[model samples]
Target chain A: MTEPILSLRQVNKSFGPAHVLKDVDFNAYPGEVMALVGDNGAGKSTLTKCIGGIHPIDSGSYEFDGRPVRVHEPRDASALGIEIVYQDLALCDNLDIVQNMFLGREERSGMVLDRASMEERALQTLAGLSVRTVTSVRQRVASLSGGQRQTVAIARAVLWNSKVVILDEPTAALGVAQTKQVLDLVRRLADAGLAVILISHNMNDVLSVADRISALYLGRMAAEVRRADIDHTRIVELITTGRSGDLGLAPEQTGETGDPDATPAAGGSDPAGEADAIRPGDAIGPVVEPAGPAETPTATDTDDEVPA
Target chain B: MTSVTPEAPQLDGPAEKPAVGGPRRSPADELKGHLQAYTARVRGGDMGSLPAALGLVVLCAVFGTLRPAFLTAGNFANLFTQGAVITTIAMGLIFVLLLGEIDLSAGFASGVAGAVLAVTLTKHGWPLPVALAATIVTGVVIGLVLGTLVARVGIPSFVVTLGGFLAFQGVVLIIIGQGGNIPITNETVLAIQNNNLSPALGWVLFALVAAGYAATRVLVARSRRRKGLDTEPLVVSAVKVAGVVAITAAAVAVLNEERSRNVMVVSLKGVPIVVPVIVVLLALGTFVLGYTRYGLHIYAVGGNAEAARRAGIKVARIRTSVFVICSTMAAVAGIFAASRANSVDPNAGGSNTLLYAVGAAVIGGTSLFGGRGRIVDAVVGGAVVAVIDNGMGLLGYSSGVKFVVTGLVLVVAAGVDALSRRRAAASGA
Candidate 1:
């Protein structure tokens, strides 16, 4: 019902001749969790990097809060209230929670760091996030568990009044308990009225927290469907094959779109389309289990061949 | 969407309470908590300065038992001056080491600066200030060149500094004219190492230092409390302040004793001027590393360069500036070396000077892996190196034996660093 706080239209990015992101459109609405799902090499990271201004989009219009904006670097994105938590978390392990939370944009009174004020703000932010596992704000990040580190990284993003916070595979390395903790925190960020873009490989995580699912299939925008309108199998289908019934790209446009000359028969025969319709009905019971490992290697093999 | 409202109540319940800075505990409980935390941290492989402190104590005990002279007040004063140059240079090395980079040329770098000082002061008849300025400028210039090569030109620091090491040795030889040495006759220059502060002045300085330290702690605590944040317990603060005062008072009292062989001939009983110089540098260095934005950036850059870059820190600039700081400090150390010898030679800051400095930093608990060091590490580590050198000489050991022993000590220090790093990783700390 409400307009997206952050939106990208017809975004394209290239790495030499690879064409990593091609005509991708994405949206993140305030007070909603938008899960961006894809296989490896599906341009999820590239799109997030573009939004965070770590990479300059080759051709795109990035609109924030109803106005076209230009983000030349990470600073520009942060200036526009966009923060990104990379899969690595980007935290300095030697620093304490307060220090890492305010790594670059430290508060200072004159030339000296304002320790009292920074500590106060850090305490309030953690409390506001209901983060209780960390015993002390002064606890070095090296001593923190995986879940606590994720909390610190997410809290760092939220500290600057950021409107859109993008997380890349936040729970990929986390244990089950930690993953649940991080997922809960992700939901809380959205509940707090921030646009949260969650990049995930887990179908359960996507189905659980996401209000809108935007699937990226080999550099193209496959589909952006509401959670209520889609089932787990359909979402996985879209991710794996770039189409689920009538929900995603047409068969002609889906296959070998990056290089049209390489697969001329892919558009005419519609083998992928026939395969999609027949497989979804029969594979619904064991969709996620067989689909993940079985589909990834072949998908990646095709991906590697395209770039070469 | 139905699950959201139920979670709102749970979030608000805990969100209203400050997770840290919870209900204030009694002093005893707070102290217990602090001790437990420290022990836990040690177990987690964050053994900062613990091994160094223990080594210093063990070394002192062993040397004291072996040689009674090592325990005397006169020898204690000797130790300060002996360690001053190495400690000063090691202090500078900490900045470079913090970035996980090595400057092998630091020794020859100091040699070059010392030669500059000797030439300007003795040959050119330059004023003390002018010579000092020239000496420091020489250091800064060397740093800029090394830093530019490493940072801007993308040469590995070890390689760049190694080339500097060989070239600067030649530069020093050229400046000192092969085997020639220049004698420094300037009173002020010579007095930096030879002279001591008056006993009264020493006491006054002790008072000022103690008061300043206590005042800082109290003010910080008060400000923290006023801001409704957690503050260290009053008892803990008092203990820390008392520890500082006790150590300083003991040092001042020991140094203030009559250490001269004959009181009538010449009285030598005050804190060495170098002590204050080291203390000042230590204070300044600690403040910059621990409390300033620039210092935090250095740590961030060292800890994770990509993260730091993404955080908007200029990694190259930090990389370059540290070299500048290291070289400038080496210059100061060179000046101290020249003053201690009362002359400048080609050997000034040559041979084991850089090794001793690097060993001091490592022995003090500065990690070779970087991002985990303090200025105080250099001082403590320098003391370890000084005691070994002084004690070996006192025990009539050959330079060969002493060098082997010191080398073994360095290896042990580095071993502790690597082992502790592994422990940290294992413990997930």
Candidate 2:
């Protein structure tokens, strides 16, 4: 019902010869959590990087707030109110929370840093996020736990009045309780009218908080489905086989013919055929190992369609 | 259980209350909290300047007990001048060391700068200001070259500076040809390390420094309070100010006492001019590292260059600028060295000069691993090194024994640094 704050159409990215992201379309609406899920090398990171302007896309139309734009660097993205909280958090361990929050963009009076203002603003931002675990704003980041560091990183992203906040594995290293805290924070971000793009490997995390789920398989977007319409098994099938039931890429476009340029066939015709290919053991076994290393893309794609 | 939606009122309700460690408690409770926090930090392996402070106290007690003359007013004055060159050089080295980079050429770099000063003033008959400017420019040029090579060319700082260490020694040797030394005849130039401030001026300087420090602390606390942010307790600020005043007053009082053995002759009863110079440098360095954006960027880059880069900081520029600051300070130290000896010699910044400077920085609690050091660390560590050197000399120990002892002391200081680093890693601090 609401228009996407950030939209990417037919996005293509290549790292030299490795076509990391191929015609991947993505969209994130305001006040919604769009969880981008994919297996390893499914171009989740590449897609995020392209959106964050860390990588220049080979060809794509990037629209932000309905305006077509070209982003060549991280500064351009941030200037448009887009921030990425990287997997490693990208925080200076030696600096305290306030210092890390305003590392490069420090508030200054003449030539001197305005410490009180920075501290006050940092406090407000953290408070606004409902972050209660951190004891002090002056405690160095090195002294913070993994979850606290994640909180600081997320707070730093939101401090700039960012419209789109992309989180890369925010809770991959966190414990169970920490994961819950972060997931709650993610929900809060979307509720506050910020488009939050959460990239995660854990299915439970996606199921719990994400309003929409977009799964990528072998650099192609397999499907973008509303969370209410998808079950656990269908999402798994899309991630592994690139197709689930009548949704996702048609059977031929799953790459059994080793054609990299095959156009996605909108929707599948045979629901019975797709259902027969939904066995977890058979689907996952062939997808894990490919026969030829030189033809990695084709080999992996052909292997993905073996069970189907 | 209630279905806690993101729109829950509980979130905003608690946020309206103070979230930074809660509201300020009573004075006693605040003090207890401060003490407990400090203790926890120390236990967590953030030792900071604790080891250096303890070492200074122990060394002073031992030396004063064994060598009564080590506590004399004259030797006390000697400590400031004796440590002045090494301390100045070490202060510069702290910048390079803060980036986890080494400048082996710093010692020889100083020697070359001194040679430039000697040549410009004595050989070319340049004015004092011109000579000083020339010497400083020489240092800047050297820094630009070394920094460019390291930051742009991607050479490791250790390798680039080691090459500089050897090359600059040759340059120094070439500049001071035929005669082994060039004696400085300029009264002003020679007086930097030899002259002293008037007794009245020393106390005036002390008063000014103490007042400035106190005012700064009070103003900062007042500003924080006005903003309704958590401020340090009044007692803590007062205690810190008092500590600074007491140390300064004691030093000034001792230096103001007549220490000339025979008072009828020349009265050497004032703080050394170099003392004020070092103090000014320390203040400037501390201000840059603590209160400036450039300094914050330096720390960020040192802590994690990748993170700094991501934060839009110019990592290469920060790296280059630190080397420039370091080499400029080295030039100042070289000028002081020339002033102290009343001449520039081939060995001006050679022998154990670089080692002494590096040792002073490390001994002061500056981490060799980078991202954690203060300018004051160099000053304190310089005092420890000077005391050891002066005390051993007063006790009539031979240079060989002194060298061995000083070497061992350096190793021990380095060991403390490594062990503390390991402790910090283990504690995840």
* Best candidate, DockQ: 1
What are the candidates' individual DockQ scores? 0.32, 0.30
Give lDDT tens digits, candidate 1, residues B217-311.
88889989999776777777888899879989999999999999999999889999999999999999999999899999989988888888878
TM-score of chain A of 2: 0.85
| Per-residue lDDT of candidate 2, residues B73-192 (tens digit) | 999999999999999999998898888888899999999999999999998999999999999998899898988898989999999999999999999999997458999989998888
lDDT of 1 by residue, A1-308 (tens): 57888877667676664667766668899999999998877888888888988787777678899898998787889999999998888989888999999998999999899999998899888877777667799988887878788899999999999999999888888766667778888998998999999999999899999988888887777778788879999998888888898777656446533433321111212222222231211222211111111112122322412331
What candidate 1 gets wrong by more than 4 Å, as runs, is A256-259, A262-308, B1-18
User: How much lDDT does each candidate structure score?
Assistant: 0.84, 0.84
Docking class of 2: acceptable
Residues A111-183 of candidate 2: C-alpha lDDT, one tens digit per residue: 9899999999998887787787777999988877777788899999999999999999988887777777788
Q: What is the lDDT of residue A103 in candidate 2?
A: 88
Superposed on the true interface residues, model 1 gives a C-alpha RMSD in angstroms of 7.4
